[model samples]
Target: GSFVLKAAHDAYVPAGQALGIDRDVFSKILDEKIAGHPNIEIVAEEVVSLDQVPRPTIVATGPLTSEPLAKSMAEHFGGDFLYFFDAIAPVIDADSIDMEKVWRADRWGKGTSDYINCPMEKELYYKFIDEVNGARKVEPKDFEKDTPFFEGCMPIEEIVRRGPETARFGCMSPKGLPYPETDKWPYAVVQLRQDNKAGTAYNIVGFQTKMAYGEQTRVFKMIPGLENAEFLKLGSIHRNLYINSPQKLRRDLSSRADEWLFFAGQITGVEGYFESTCTGLMVSMFLDAKLSGDEKPEFARETAFGSLLYAITEEEKENFQPTNINFGLFPPLTTDLDGKPFKGRDKKLKKQLICLRARLRARKVASYQN
Candidate 1:
């Protein structure tokens, strides 16, 4: 019941290729293009109360969803709603960045040398670390209790707290990536990646921090590329709410008690932008079938969407945590490889195989839908 088989198949998609559904402007195009669908009507209105709307409708009031709606949702679901904190990294203006110290390269020169690397000497790196560790942390508001952060997106200071060198080994490690001029590796590296389509904004690559606004400005500029860095937005932390979906929701993404209401996006415990969008599509498909008097959409266990759904719907709830769409969630393939019974890197390859199977499965699903 895992989707690793599906993700394994998707592993070899060519670089720069887009997968899943085309979500960009297509969604608006869909709103216009399909505006004439007999059963479909897209309404542009905020529902202050779910009771005011029709029943059997979904309340996908995402993370920034309104308080009244959120409260109404909690009450309808009964018991307490689960929550987790999600963070957004600060955006930096491209023109303001000093290109002298920042070099663009993909680590090891992989596809699309798209990342901006800010090389750091040991002394300078330590100073940056000192400021990060000493920055003032904000106190979260009372309504944010259910929004504890997941380990993957923990702020830079939290990583620093683990050990002095934890961040270097993780986000800032300079191994394999070296400066061409000196043929020497930096002691640590700060990276920035373009945040939007126009490339006007870039985010501090691995520099998610909870530092106060004044301190974030004072500290982060110490890096080589950012001595005069102008910040479009400062980094800060906030709590997000989520449920342990594996224990709470089914593969159809419905709660145990209220099967009619489906969960989607980050709130369902799937991480990553694509993962959230895919869930929304899946929910749309599921609801589409229901509205058409057809059976609920049943995704093949071999698809990426299927794999992610399996992970969220199948893990132990108490121990279940948020997961991004990856091959690991797919079921292992029956490999003929004799070495070590298919583990480690071998397992990774198997995931690719599963993804291929998923692709084929998706083609079939598409054909059936058509």
Candidate 2:
């Protein structure tokens, strides 16, 4: 008989929403949900190694994975197991963005006018930098203090601490992006990228930080277009460890060295709460199908879930990195069913069509499975 084992404190709450809910309330809800399932066994102990467990185990420890298990996994994988201090940027409610102050345009008019750019005057930019530099930051735990942060994903405060000119030169640069009406560039620009399919949320591009939740809300609102911004999720930083999944795991997310072992969630290089949850679901489906001697079901490639799985399992091996669900991971739909070219059409309309097609295909797959 198979059983589920999880550490008592090993909950699946996202770091971005950690400060939003009371810990006791969150834990109680989680415990209640898990208790409804008969197979789950919450072990009030640590999982130090895979060797102590039975075969056919699935590891989904997420970004803040335990040190002992992480060490054991690294030894099992053998290649350069990557570690990075991941900083999550704050997500804002789309309705709260002040459209009058900001304009939508892609840099250099290269792609669709998708990004919301908030221009800042020279004085305002300087003031913003000063505030960010002085904001209270979350202190790392003792174990995480020594781990180095990846340069590409450094916290906003850490970037500001580098130099006053760093932000303007890097993420906040005004070059190649002129205001739509004025046709002039401001001293600095803060860009927000669409975060969901419905355009209900946007994330501050390159503004990932370790700032205290209150401080993040306060300082970010100082930006021109976000004076009354409503935060959907706040910025956070955590020590993330993941295997090179493309090189280490099979397409089914099973270990190449041992078919009995499986990997999922952040440990297998998929990021975000939604993506991790999808992986867990997919792995379960695969395992169930395999044990029952049935053919593995395939997810539609056009769907977000399938695209994320493809990126982690089938992307190039040399520079394998953890990825969140995004349109870039999805396959491009260049033509319609009638073989009509989709080029030179309105980008928003094209995206809508793509999403519609994906949804329809996914429904067909689901119906077939039923």
Candidate 3:
């Protein structure tokens, strides 16, 4: 295909705006964006050793980092874990959900009715569990067999292996949410959170799996509301390598051992296209400031940029894992704009408040260089 410019939007994207770029199109646009820029060269070569890379450099080699470079990084940083297998959850067409079989509500009566609940009776939930346990899983690659799965992205089937009731206590728990159209809680439930601003798609929260795609399509459709569900993206598993940024990188995402060295993208342990791009953009800004002798500005924690940076740079050092930019990363709100304490029900206003605060702060994260 010839070079084409196209725009797309995704819920996972901060601010819900993105450009859908394929490889050829990406090359064309990158050339255009950096046209006539000084002191930049696009070198097409195999980066076998980090030692050979120039100073003031960034390593944004992404998930499928080359073996040699990964080796160099491990040896240089004295850190382990060349890789881990991660599973992604499926995204469903929101319109396909049988609204009659599912009801919208916030679990535990917290926040707005931000999740679509698929209620299942005891018989159905048990049957679904049996099917899930019996479904054919994707066989691991030779390299993936020894690699551990990230705890945060643990596949649902793997959880089931611990016990049939494990899921009942985990993601499929119905402890707080009552059954659809009734006060009595269902035996188990499936929750779908809005995955896009348009509400066109819903992600099956915490449903990452290693089930074969065909088995996934057949088994997942057994849930009450998703009988005719259209999967926008099917769950998948892959090997990924990311650094422990909180312990390894600095506030500006530069190396602690080498001020001139920087890291970005998935290598920094962020798990989305938007997060990776933000890491690169932010790193460039910080690197430019350091090299040019200007103070680097920081994003407010209220903003997605800051929240993501906070995740990679300042999150709990123990049991670190990659994650998409999410509202969970945002700081909790305690009061309304009037500075009064919020009522119990006002917790529903929390997301809107966070967005409002982020928008206000994002205006001041300037990018233009002197």
On residues 1-370, what C-alpha lDDT tens digit does candidate 3 reach at each position? 1112222221122111222223333555557656645776677789899899889799889988988988998877788744678899998998899998888777777666777888888888888888999999999878678877877789999888889889888898988799655688888888887765566777798899899999999999998899999999899998899888888889899877788889999889998666887888889889888888898868889899999999998887567778888889998777666778766565547778878878877876643332
Q: Candidate 2's residue-wise lDDT over 189-257, tens digit each?
A: 998887654567788989999999999999999999899999999989877888888888887898888
Cα lDDT of model 1 by residue, 1-370, tens digit: 2232233233322222222222233344445545767887788788876577764665566666676777776776664666666555677888888988778777776766677788888887787788888888776677764456766787888788888889899889887678968778899888787665556777886677777888888888887878888899888776565666776677777767676777888878778766877888888788788778887776777788888887878766565567887767776665433423444566556666676778888888878777
TM-score between candidate 1 and the true structure: 0.82
Query: Sorted on TM-score, highest at the top, how do the candidates line up?
Result: 1, 3, 2
Q: Rank the candidates by lDDT, best first.
A: 3, 2, 1
Residue 321 shift from truth in candidate 3, angstroms: 1.4
Compared with the true structure, all predictions reach lDDT values of 0.71, 0.80, 0.80
Candidate 3 C-alpha error for residue 247, in Å:
1.1
- lDDT, model 2, position 305: 72
Q: Which is the winner by TM-score between candidate 1 and candidate 2?
A: 1
The superposed Cα distance between candidate 3 and the true structure at residue 348, in angstroms, equals 1.8
Clashes of each: 20, 0, 0
In angstroms, give how far residue 107 of model 2 lies from its true place: 18
Error of 3 at 196 (Å): 14
RMSD of each predicted structure:
5.4, 8.5, 6.7
Evaluate residue 258 in candidate 1 and report its C-alpha lDDT on the 0 to 100 scale.
72
lDDT: worst 10-residue window of model 1: 13-22
